[model samples]
Target: MTSPDARMLASQNIVLILCGNKKDLDADREVTFLEASRFAQENELMFLETSALTGENVEEAFMQCARKILNKIESGELDPERMGSGIQYGDAALRQLRSPRRTQAPSAQECGC
Candidate 1:
């Protein structure tokens, strides 16, 4: 059963990572690594076994997510201008909005006073 937030994020084409934490306590783990990995594969999500106690794969997990997002953006699969969440707006959005290549104005234009 997927959470409503997960469904919402999935609908937005967001890259998802299924991290199995507490690798340091592997012996006491109820969920086997193979099981988690298989589940992640079935769900088409990146999987990582992380340990907060030892900080194992913690950085790598985040890096993987970032890399996937960057790859999607570079490949034009993700459009920052069209996305409504999970992305920060700054110079890139402004540049895209004011770009000479942009032929159409935004759908909802508001003049901030």
Candidate 2:
């Protein structure tokens, strides 16, 4: 199937994050990524990829999506006061998303090297 039109998709405030289940098939799905990325880049729609099996770049992918959504809101792409305006995300959701995660970083206590 052909990739969805980015222009049309970007007109709305919806960001589509598509993750390919099979790594082997991802290469064949270049057109989809190309179209999606192009649409995101041109219209500031967030597009990203992640791997649940490998847990690769999963956080970054979601963060990128969040960032894009935030940017869209900041840019007035979607009305903040208007609920569900063209798939508008809630401020509370964004606030939770922007909150810092409590992750312990590697320190000398944990690393002998």
Candidate 3:
């Protein structure tokens, strides 16, 4: 199920990262480093072992993903306006919806109250 999803995302030029987390508990690790690395290589995805507890490689992983996204954006490979791109630039309506001014209720005169 997940493999097909990954393939579909890959086909759509999405950046993928296969993360093996919990490096802080290396002794309790079930999946070996080699296995995870091999899987990531086979799937053509970037691999990282991160530890949220120790903050090891966590920032690197995010930076790598962000860099890839920025590269794609710069190269025009990824369009923020494209459907299914998981990004949306605010249109006028969307901007209005997000604007703080919209939070205020209309005055009684404006509402004809």
Candidate 4:
């Protein structure tokens, strides 16, 4: 992830997730979990190991990413009004998503965090 392309995205304030998929294949692993964890920690990124076959942590990865993005938007770090911010309230869910009642962040139990 230290590549130039990744750096360009970081320059754009993109929220990145370092996902190591196929977590069920522990026997054929080439990279260690500690290595990935250290890299993610050093880079200030969200990381997860998911398994498509077992459906483990797959949904959690997406949910975590969405939560981070929503938090960023709520904190005014990411502006939905700004172009290229990669954030927008869709027309179908706009009203519900932007409802004033949803101002508070979800509880840990609610978010499964």
Residue-wise C-alpha lDDT for candidate 1, range 56-75, written one tens digit per residue:
99999999988877666666
Ranking by TM-score: 4, 1, 3, 2
lDDT of 3 by residue, 1-113 (tens): 03776666553776778878899998999999999988888877899999988899989998999888766766667766678776555675643322223347788768734
Those runs of model 1 whose alpha carbons end farther than 4 Å from true positions after fitting are 1-5, 9-11, 83-86, 89-113
TM-score of candidate 1 against the unseen true structure: 0.70
Q: Write the per-residue lDDT of candidate 4 for residues 24-112, one digit (tens) a residue.
A: 99999988999999999998788999899999999999899888877777667877777777777678556354433364788876973
Q: Report lDDT (CA) for all predictions.
A: 0.74, 0.60, 0.75, 0.79
Candidate 3 clashing pairs?
none
| TM-score, cand. 4 | 0.75
* All candidates: TM-score: 0.70, 0.45, 0.66, 0.75
Flag the better candidate by TM-score, 1 or 2. 1
Error of 2 at 27 (Å): 11
When summed lDDT is taken over every stretch of 10 residues in candidate 1, the lowest stretch is: 94-103
lDDT score, residue 7, model 2?
38
- Greater lDDT among 2 and 4 belongs to 4
How far is each candidate from the true structure, as Cα RMSD in Å? 10.5, 8.5, 10.9, 6.0
- The residue-level lDDT of candidate 4 at 9 comes to 64
Q: Regarding lDDT, does 1 or 4 come out ahead?
A: 4
